[model samples]
Target chain A: MKILVPVKQVPDTATQVKIGADPKGIDTAGITWIVSPYDEYALEEALRIKEKQGQGEVVAVTVGPERAKEALRSCLAMGADRALHLSDPAWENADSLTVARALAAVIKQEAPPLVLFGRQAIDDDMGAMPAQVADLLGWPCASWIMEETISEDGKSVRAGRQVEGALEIFTIPLPCVLSAQKGLNEPRYPTLKGIMGAKKKEIKDVKAADLGLAADGAQLLVVALEALPPRPPGRIIPGEPAEAVKELVRSLREDAKAI
Target chain B: MQIELSEEQQMIQALAREFAEKEVKPVAALLDAEARFPHETVKRMGELGLMGIAVPEAYGGSGADTVAYVLALEEIAKACASHAVIMSVNNSLYCDPVLKYGTDEQRKKFLAPFASGQQIGCFALTEPQAGSDATNQHTLAVRDGDGYVLNGRKVFVTNGREAAVALVFAQTDPAKAHRGISAFLIERGTPGFLVPKVEDKLGIRASDTAEFVFEECRVRAANRLGEEGMGFKIAMGTLDGGRIGIAAQALGIAAGAFDLSVAYAKERKSFGVPIAQHQMVQWMLADMATAIEAARLLIWRAAALKDAGRPFGPEASMAKLFASEMAMKATTDAIQVHGGYGYIKEYQVERYFRDAKITQIYEGTSQIQKLIIARHVLGAR
Candidate 1:
């Protein structure tokens, strides 16, 4: 079985965000990059499935600028057999639809048995790409898959997902798409040998224009961007243990109204 | 003593555990069975700034504190004890002494490679007759003109077969007894110094234990650590740092055993319900958890003291004694919880049980720890 995992590189969100001076985006300088947190889950699930089958290659695909090679290289280091880079300047400000269109063209060409992606990119926190790609591929798709198992005959896969406060298991046919959720499996780190090997693996880069995508389709568009509201100042309440607990409960119920 | 780890220390523990489980654990058993070092894992750890965790950044190390180093060793040891001991000896015995006492030239030449993991190191103090009686050294270092001629045999030297440099202890003044000892930097392949044999050990099988014979091994006087009569102090101080590493190793071994036992208890069934439902099994887990927490607190307290430049002699001894004993008991009980499956090698609890015994023996035996602690308590030598 051939598996393809689409990974995105985004600024590590856990780090303190340095808002751009313009207040519309993040400060890019010196910000570290990580494979989209959700995407790591996706890659891990794909690797797990490949290992269980004991056959086939787990390929990685990414749509980004040239600097994005670092994230792709990391995927290979983490045991992905091959990588495909869909490089296009148009992708810089492209919305989810255009990005999905570029990936769909590559998927059709590779014709992998399955496709996987993270639920969202931690940077944008959009949570839209997977479903968009699945729609573009015209295949059965499952999002937020917490557990997955392929059938003995390879005809179908069963996926468990969180829904409405419970886990709902679904069975989907082959040639499907899956968006990996957290708690699926732990992702492996790249070993020194794996890092060395990743440097040698071929990364095929094709222009979005070459995939018969229209130049206008590649046209970048950002309607507007704005900063989120700053979090309220923290308040610390100190008192006796029981009194503190009671006060905390009162604040949550009356002030925050979270209870 | 302050028993909590700083934020940096906690980060090191998390990072090391992530690296070991993801990069090292997959191959630990295979490498141990084949008696092969996991070179790739070690190299990767070096890249992650782990090998010389406690070494200062100025000397090609990560400059992390003692607690961080201890935490990192614990994670690595949980995956493979052999690699952990190698790391411990290099950081505590070889690189640390040079950084603490060496000339600028020596730090640049000898300390850099070991700290950066470009080369390995070993510590040679235990002669065949001087296992626990460390002061009774038979090795001799005689001044011959501008150099010192070293002649002796060092047995059970951890990492001896693979080390590029060895911090060797020899008697420089027999009349001074313990104060007579002096340390020398013996580079491997020095003329007249040879690795005669590597011992096959019951545990940490992947780590090479070898004997060295030094026959008229001439080293420049510049290589001596500190001054005459400083070897015993160097050896003891080195072991004080080493004890923390051993304590961390013990904690890791116990953790590995405890995790496996917990999983087994929740799944394995004897009388319809899961084995974890039994009261005795619950007691074992509760005791293990409580002991492990206490052990971690003590180990961290000692590490914090060392980092703070305080004398941690007593705390180090106490932590080592408690953690090693805890590991022995925990691994044995892990086997008991597994019942018959634990008796076999396939289940791996038996291996953990076997591995846990050595932590108590090496890095000062449990008896020696008691002596140190009691001496500290009574203000006696």
Candidate 2:
């Protein structure tokens, strides 16, 4: 029972995001790239499932350029048994659908009982891969999954999402797509033994051509991007306390329209 | 010469930084205020293979070199200096010597568990009389049948109260001076061993400084490290490596304080603008950055030398001397940058200021390092 996990690298949450000279991209200078936060939960859940079964492998796959190998390496260090890297230059500028095509190819080849993804790649917040890849693989998709239980024989899963103070539950058969949410489980840091041994673990190259795929799928086109303007300073509603309250209410209903 | 870190080193650094920032930093202030030893985190460190970073996996270690060890240590120190010293003492003072000098059998018992951080270990060399003159020994170990009966009072021993093993130095042949000293691995709760007192420290209070009393403590001959009368040499060799670790620690403390000062300067306003806009504050930050870089380079050179199997005693000494002094200066300037807010405990630069002071005094004092450098410079022993 192998659980396949697809991950994407994103700018560290702490880094200041600056729009690049190219409107479609971001400034890469001095940016510290990290495995996306929710994706960490996805990989962590895969590892947990393998450990719970006591006899299984957790395979990680990533679609990115050369630097994306570091992302796969991080997964391996966090106890993934093996990794597949779609590092062909063709994948570098691929849209979400094309990346999903590569992932679906790998998932089909691996034939894992389950495939997992972060709800969204934080870099772009697209959250498009799970549905796109599920359509490609002809599998049921469970998005924003918070809790899951595998049936005794591991043929199906009962998944749930927290919504409006209630659990929205669904039953999906094995060989399905599940996108992880924050409340799923806490991710563990890479242990010393894991890091030392990660180098010896396998990360096989996965060429785009080998997957019978071309980077041509574009369901959505991104236009020019601009930074959000800095917020203006708050204005003081002056006068006596009672008059100030009257003025604040008038401003909220009129100029601000916040009330 | 690729000055950039290798992938492995970066991984180690990231792991350590995460642990430090998420786990250690949150509790650092409470640990310092309470002066409680960080037992939980220390045990986890052992589990993480931090206690034996340089020790090989075959011997229950990370199988990393000194560079990785320093990188990890500096990260921990940047969050909390107490955790840094706890790690440094275990890695350089205890596990390191045992791995280097102990036989394969001794390594299995003495080095393995300590390196894995299952149990704490301490170095027992400093006595009340043997402060600067480490050779002046009052403790004595008399040869008895298959082992030696030891009697000694060792002071200022880090990790002493909690340690499972102690690497003790005593004069087996007093007439031979420093040459007469022999090192022994003594386990806690072995008949006559006692921890009489734990010291109240000025800084790094989360770590224990204890007084160890050995009364007719019988140690097995197999527990002895290296040849007889080789204790002083082993101690010196161990301190050389220990100094490099301390140098890295000092660098982290300074760097950590500098980081705080920078953030504070950017936020703290004076005369209707951020203090960072002032040239005086900028100059201070620039000086701290320059000093930290210098200290880091020195530590790296020494660590690289050690990894490449070269003599690095004088270089280690230089690193310790310069880095410790730099830490003191940087932390002080950090406090100044914070103004009255720095005086408060919540601001944390005061804690850094206190932690930085010990880096100048412990492992080997900055003055003693100067002596070692002078001796090396004159081509004299």
Q: Find the candidate with the highest DockQ and give its number.
A: 2
Worst 10 residues of 1 chain B by lDDT: B1-10
DockQ for each model = 0.05, 0.77
* Residue-by-residue lDDT tens digits, candidate 2, B1-381: 668877888999999999999998999999999999999998888888899999998888888889999999999999899999999999999999999999999999998888888987999999998977899988998999999999989999999998999999999999999999999999999988899999998999999999999899998888899999999999999999999999999998998899999999999999999999999999999999999999999999999999999999999999999999999999999999999999999999999999999999988888899999999999898
TM-score of each: 0.65, 0.98
Query: How far does residue A157 in candidate 1 sit from its true spot (Å)?
Result: 34
lDDT value, residue B337 of candidate 1: 95
Q: In model 1, where do residues sit more than 4 Å from their true spots?
A: A1-259, B1-7
Docking class of 1: incorrect
- For the predicted complex of model 2, DockQ is 0.77
Q: For model 1, state the Cα shift of residue B361 in Å.
A: 1.1
Model 1: per-residue Cα lDDT over A123-193, one tens digit each: 87888887888888889898988899999999899999878788899999989998888888877665333
